[model samples]
Target chain A: MIGSWMTLPLVLVAAPPPPLDPDPRASPPAAAVEADPKAEVPPLPLRDARRAEQAPPPDVMRAADNPRVPKAKPGPPFYDAADEAVFRARFDLTKDPAPPPRTVRMRCLVADPLCGITVEVQALSAYALRAQQGSVATANARTWHSARAQYDVWVQFPAVVRTIGRTRFNVLSMGPKGGIVASDGGDLWANVGLAMRAFFGKGAFAPHLEVTGALAFRIGGFTEGGAGFFGAGRTDLGPVRSPVGFAMDIGVGLGGFGSLVIGGQYDSPLAREEVPESLRTPAAGMFYVGFRGNILWGAPAAAAVTTHVLAGRLVVPER
Target chain B: MRAGVRPLRGRAGVGYRVHAVVILPLASVLLVASLASPAAGSEAEAPPRTNRYLEAPPSSAPAGEDFGPFFTGPPASETSFVKAPRRGSGLAPRLSVRDGLFCFVEDAHCVASLLASTDVGIGMAIIGENGPDLPYAQLTFRGGFSLRPVTLYRKRYHPWALGLTASYSVGTGGIRLQAEDVVETARTQATRIALVNQLWLWHRPHAFHLDASIGAVRSGVLGRDERIHDLWGTHVELALGFGGWASLVVSGDFLDEDTRIVFGFRTHALAGVPVAGLTALGLWAGGVL
Candidate 1:
C-alpha cells in the first residue's frame, strides 16, 4: 500500500503542472501588447483569426435579411372584401360559373303606297338585314357619319277595272211639262288605276301622303226617236254619245305600326261629252270618300310586304 | 137471224130518208136565190120612170137644187165643221178624272195623265205535272205608276212619261241540286224598287219606248233553313219598248248574287188613254232577281 502511495505521488508529479499562462508565448505577447504603450500589433494573422471566429456565414445572413427585402405590394389585394362577398353570394365559384355570350336584335316599320296613313308589318330575319339597312355609316376618328338614307317605295297596281257605265239626260222647258226630251243610250267600259306613297316619322306620330290616278275608257250612251202620243212616227232625238275620262286623288295620312286613313277625292271629266246635240246639257262631276287600313304581321317598318284593305262611297253630281 | 136482218134494213131506210130530206131543201133554196138575183139586177138597171110617182117627195130638197123624188139634199154637211170663234169663248173645257187604270185630264192648254198599277203572280213548283211530291212555288208581285201628259207645242209624236216600280217577291224556287241531294228545297225572297223614265220615241202604228231604272235590290235565300241575305245590291236596267198599244219590252238587269247579270222580255197591251186600260204579259229567264 506504501508502494502504491509512492507511485501515485510520482504519477501526480508526472502530470503537467497547471499552466500559469494559457500559452507562454501567447501570454507574453498579449501581456507585452497590453503593457506596451505603443506596441507593433500583429495585424494580418490575428485580425484574420478574430474575424473568422466572430463574422456570420454569408448564406445565414442572406436568409436572416430576406423578409426586409423590398416586396411588390401584392397587387391591390386580389379582390376587395365586399367583392368577395358578392361573388360568393351570387355564384358558386367552386362549381365554375359560365359566362353569358353577347347578342343583338333589330326591327323596322313600313308604309303603304296607296294610302299614306296605312302601316304594315312583316317578320324579318338576318337574311333581310342587308336589304333593310337604311344607310351606310363610316367611322372618322371617334364619330360615325351616315352616307345617305335609302328608301324603298311600294306601289299598287289595281287588278280589277271599273268604269262609269251609262248616263241618262233630261231637259226641262218653259212649260211645266213642256220641252223636247232626249236621252242617250247606256254604255259599258273599263278603268285602270295606280297609286303610290312615301312616309316620314316614327312610331305613332308618323305622317304620310298618297297620290292616285285612274283612266277610264269607252263610256257612251245611245239616243232614240219619235213615237205615238207625240202625233208622229218614231224619230230619234239626240245623236250618239261618247265619253272618256281620268280621275286624280291626293290624301294625307297619319298612323303608327298599324294605321287607318280616311280621305276624299274630286274627279272631273277629262274629256268633253261626245254627243254633239247633248253638249248643251249640264256635265256631271264625280267624287268619293274612302277609308283604308293596313294589317301587319309584325312591326310596320320592318315588314317586307303588308296587306291593305279599302272601302269607299262613290257619288256623282246631278247633270 | 131473220129478225136482225129486218131491223138492219129498217135502220138503213130511215137514214136514207133523212139524208134526202136535208139535201132537197138546201138544193131548192140555192136554186131560187140564183134565179132571183138576175131578175133583181135587171130591175135595178132599168128602173121605170113610172116608179117616180110612188116615191116620197120634197121639202127634203134644198132650194135651187134639182131633186129626184128619191134624192136627199146633200146630207146636211155630212162632214161636221166647227167654226172658229172670235176669241176663246168656244174652247173645249178641261176634263180630269181618276180611274183604276189611269188618271186623265184634257184641257185646251194641256193634257196630262197618270196611271198606277200593281200585279202579283204565283207559279207552281212541281217535279212533274202529276208527280207525287209537293214543294213551295214561286210568287212575284209588282206595283207601279205611270204619268203621261201631252204638252202643247211639244214634239207631237213623243210622249213624256215617268214610271216608278216597287216590287216584293217571296217564294222557294232558288234551290240548287248538290251531290248529297239530287233535289233540294230552297226558299228565296227579294224586295226591290225602281224609278224609271219612259221616253216614247215613236207613236205611229207602233211606239218605240226607251226606259232606264236605277234601283236597289235586297235578296235572300233559305237553303234547308240557312239564311243568306245580300244587301247593298244595286242594279241598273235598260229596256227597249216596241209595237203599238201591244208593246214588247226587252230589258237587261243586274243582281247582287255573285253580281249575276239577267235579261228578260215583257209584252203589254193598252186601250184608252195613256194612264188607263193597260194589261201586260211577261216571261223572264236568267239570274234570279
Candidate 2:
C-alpha cells in the first residue's frame, strides 16, 4: 500500500498541466550596456552628491534608459581607493568630461594623437590600470598605399630644438610643430621628416622642418636638375658656361601644414668653371652658391585616415 | 657645330639672367614673411579652458563612416584638409608621340618623333614649326632601347629606375648660316647614351612623377665644308607629372652652344597619346612616347 501511495505521487509528478497562455514571456530582461557608434550622447553631467543609502530598484535598472546604478553606503571600496586614485592620477585626463578636456593628457586624447571617444572609458580605466599598464588598449592606423606621402612620425611631448642638428616626439603624435602643446593647438618647429609609426599604423605627413643632403653620381654620364628647392647643387645651363659643381645644401621643409620647402645649393669649386674669352665672359651662371625654394606649394602627397578605437577596462563587483 | 653672338655690345654685367637666381625671389619670400605671423610661442599650453571636459566620443568615428573594428578612416570632406589622391602608374607600356621645337627663341624651329616603351624604342624629330631653318637643318628620327639593368631605391611599389639609354641617329642638321641669322644648327648622325632616373615624387592633388636624367650624347657631324667633328655633350631632363599620364617636362642637352630646352606642358589621357604642344626656348613638343 505504501509503495502504491509513492507510485501515485510519482504519477502525479509525471502528469502534465493543462494548457494556459500559448506565448512565452520573460520575467524581466536586463538592458544591454553599449553605446551606439553614431549616438550623439550628451555629456554626462558632473555630480558632487553624497553616496546614497538605498540601491536603485532592480526593475528600474532593467528598464530605464540612461540608467545609473546607485552607489553602496560609504564603506571601504571593493578595492584600494588610493591605489585606484593613484592609477587615476597616472592619467591626467581621467577627470570631468566637459566640452574641452581639462587635463593635458585628456587634451591630447581629444585633440591630436589619441581619439577622444574613449575618455569616459579611460576615466574608469584610470583605476583599473593600477595593476597592469600592460593591458592598455591600442588601435592601428590606416594603411597608405602611396610611397611619396607615406611618411609617418611619432613626436615626443616637449620637443627639443637645436641649431643645425638633432631630432626627436610624444605618443605617435605627429608633433611636427615641435613638442610644444598649445591650447589653441599649434607648435613651433612642428615635427617632420623621418617617419614614426602612428598608433594605428598609417603614416601622417609631419609638419616639422627637415633639412637633408644627398650625393648624386651620374651613371657613366650622370647629371642633376638645376635651380630650385627641388634641384640639386648644379647648373648646366649651356655651352660657354656649363658650370658643374659638387652640391652643398641647406634645405627646410614644412610638414603636414603644407609640404613647402627651400633648398639652397653651393657646388664645390670643383664644379664651377671660369672659362674667359677675349673681352667678354660667358654667363657662367650667377650665384655660384645658388639656392632653390622654387617649389612654392605642393599638394598633400598622401591621404590621412584617422582611425579611433575605444578600449579599456573598468572594475565593478556583481550586485 | 655653331658660332656665338657677342654679348650685347659693351653692357654685360650679369643682367636679366640674374633675376632667375636672386632679387625677385628674395623680394617674394620677404613679402610672404611679412604677411605671416611670427611662429607662435614654441611651447603651447593647452588652450586655457575655463570649463573643459571630454566632448562625448563624437558619438561615432570623428569622420562620417560606418564603424567596423578595422576599416579605412573617414573620407575627407571637400573642405577637410586631408585628401586622397592616387598616383597612377602601371606596367603598361606608354606609346608616346613627340615633337621637339628646337631653338624656338634663337632659330624658331621644331622636330617630330614617335617612341614606345622601357625596352626597344624609337623617336623622330622631323616636324617643323617655322620654315626659315628647315632647309638648313632638316630633321631626323632615331630609335633604340633602354639598358636599365638595375634599380636604386624602391619603397612600397614605386621603383627608382636607373637606366642606361642608348640610341643611334641618322638625320640632317647641316647648317648654312648667313652672316645675319643668329642660329646654330644641330644636324648629325650620332650615338647617344644617357643615365636616366625616373622617380615618382608625390601622388596627391595631382600626381607628380619626376623623370630626372643625366647622360652623355656624342654626335659625328660632317659640315657643309666637308669637315667632321664629333659633337660630345651631356644633358638633363626634369619631367614632373601632374596627371597619371601627362607630365610637364623641361629637358636640355648641355655641352652644346645651340642647346635648346624642350618643354612639354600639354595634357594627356592616361590611356591615350601624351603630347606637349607648346615651346618656350627649345621645342614646342618633347618626346611623344
Best by DockQ: 2
Candidate that would win on lDDT: 1
Q: A1-319, model 1: which lDDT tens digit per residue?
A: 1232223222212212223233423433667867895766444455455765665422111111224333223234334344544665777543222221111111112332112111121111111000111112432112111111001112222222111111111111010000000011111112223344434432233465555454332211222321111112232211121122444445556632233323222222223332122122222323333333232333322221111100001111112
- Candidates 1 onward: DockQ, in order: 0.00, 0.02
Per-model C-alpha RMSD: 57.9, 29.4
The recovered share of true contacts, given per candidate in order, is 0.00, 0.00
**Number of the predicted model whose TM-score against the real structure is largest:** 2
TM for every model, in the order presented, reads: 0.23, 0.23
Per-residue C-alpha lDDT of model 2 across residues B162-212, encoded as one tens digit per residue: 444443322223232333332222223344555656553421212244567
Q: What's the TM for chain B in candidate 2? A: 0.37
What would you estimate as the lDDT of candidate 2? 0.23
Query: How would you class the docking of model 1?
Result: incorrect
- Per-candidate clash tally: 29, 50
* Poorly placed runs, candidate 1 (over 4 Å): A1-319, B1-140, B147-158, B170-172, B176-187, B203-206, B222-225, B242-247, B250-253, B258-289
